[model samples]
Target: MFVLTMYVMLLTLDDYKPTYQDRLATPGMMIRPKGNALEISYNSEDTESWDLYVQALDNFLAPYNESQQIMNNKDCTPNTYFIQEDAGEIRNNPKRSCQFNRTVLGNCSGINDRYYGYPDGQPCVLIKLNRVIGMLPGKDDQSPYVTCGAKVNYSQPLVAVKFLNVTYNADINVECKINSLAIANPTSDRDKFAGRVSFKLRINKN
Candidate 1:
């Protein structure tokens, strides 16, 4: 029996710094901001279904939740923001809210009367892996062969919120990296193999 091992490394924005333009160049990834929403896309060569990709994205953002239910660990389901592809619109799910302040004035006297906005007002950016292509078996005649492997890294971009009062501002960003892939079929005598590919994302704020 032949054994094939695959290793994936997890990285945050702190590991490496990359410009916004560089991160956008990565394959199978797209980041765009609409009138009031952010859209992130991920493409891959794996055969994983769309549902699986959504699950993976959910897992990736699990730690950023600030809901009371989640903090209590009471089996509370966190909120997920959804974006409609056709209309290019964003809607907050039952657990989440997509509200933002629209008015910002230069004078402090006019805006200082209201209470400070909570950090929760910021919309959570969601990432969805879309499609995968160009995957093939390895060329080696060995009984067990490695298909392919690759690594990608990028910094996370920050979404800024300017307060309508007190000139206060808050910025949030997340960095992501993906690596590792291995495919093998043991019963086949034809010596078939496959290769692996990877992608990384990075975002920054000025």
Candidate 2:
């Protein structure tokens, strides 16, 4: 009887499928800048580990032409803006918890990129900024808190290594795990949901 019972239980287990609960951050969720960096961590008493993804659309372009050329000796104002329109906002609120299994990270789509297979990619976190912040490069001898080059249309999203951090699980999927992401500044008009970002890892010698 014991042997027969064990076999039946095994069959039941094989038919089981995992049920995941997705989460979203509430509006007005605070995301403040810290010195040269801004970051967030994942915490849930019950939720298990999950994956993170970003996909800067194949056609993401900065809304403005503010980025100017760097003169040989003089300093030029950064074309990038620290705050973005489509992006959420920036406020100094106590750190909040992350939503679980939620694919959409930001308030709008332009910047809330989930993921899609692409050969060329960069490491980034799919997140929603309360406000779309511009790349306010570091001035003087200070290394740019966050820096990016000329805006390239339909190009991979940029990463500001000195500016963002994800500290829940140290081991992250670069395709999903990253130390930086390029958040472009808009000098013009934009749609409601328009930006996206994605990251990729070199698997083989392809």
Candidate 3:
């Protein structure tokens, strides 16, 4: 009688970074207060209704806080993607991620006012791009920036309301597009949010 034995082996990187990515969809923009539906509705007079929105922004920004960033990440040159050729590891570390200081957000950072403008009916909506490994955004000297405008009038709309009037409720349709030469803007309805995002903002006093 003859017997045969076979051994199988799977190879992976030492740093655990994916050797190959099979993602079909491109990186897209995302907004807070996420749900099955993409709509932001809040009562201006009710603090309870908008406090959660402020909490969401605070939770989202916790990692980007100044103290947290000082420990783990290092600053890189602005307006340019930092390319490190060393797969060889740095100071016994496999990789070092760039730090995005929360202070860069300025007034929206939730540093000075913890309300994040939500209580005043001037909520700060946080929009961010999904990260893709080994992806280079923009081309030449042109950098990628997110441009948002009102969908109805096709112009920038005022996002703040000093006080809510019972007779007038602010309702605005907004669309944000990521502008970059390296990105593809899909025209099909199926791929509507490919390089852009759209949502409605409704602030009511009642």
Candidate of highest lDDT: 3
Q: What would the TM-scores of all predictions be?
A: 0.19, 0.19, 0.76
- Model 2, span 1-206: residue lDDT tens: 99999898776662223233222111111111111122222222222211222222322212211231111112323343233133255433332222122122132223343322111122232223232222323334332121122111211122222113323335333211212223232211232222322222221111
lDDT of 3: 0.61
Q: Residue 32 of model 1: what lDDT?
A: 20
Q: Provide the clash count, candidate 2.
A: 32
What are the runs in model 3 whose C-alpha is more than 4 Å off? 1-10, 13-15, 23-25, 87-93, 150-170, 186-188
lDDT of 1: 0.25
lDDT of 3 by residue, 57-117 (tens): 7788899888898888878776667665754644344566777776666556678768866
Candidate lDDT (C-alpha), each: 0.25, 0.25, 0.61
> Which ten contiguous residues of candidate 1 have the minimum total lDDT?
148-157
lDDT of 1 by residue, 1-206 (tens): 12222222223222322222321212232222211233222222222312343344334433434453245333422233223233344422223323222122111111332211122121222222222222221234222121211111111111121222221132323332222222332222231111112222222112
What 10-residue stretch in candidate 3 is worst by lDDT? 152-161
Clashing pairs in 3: none
Q: lDDT order of candidates, best first?
A: 3, 2, 1
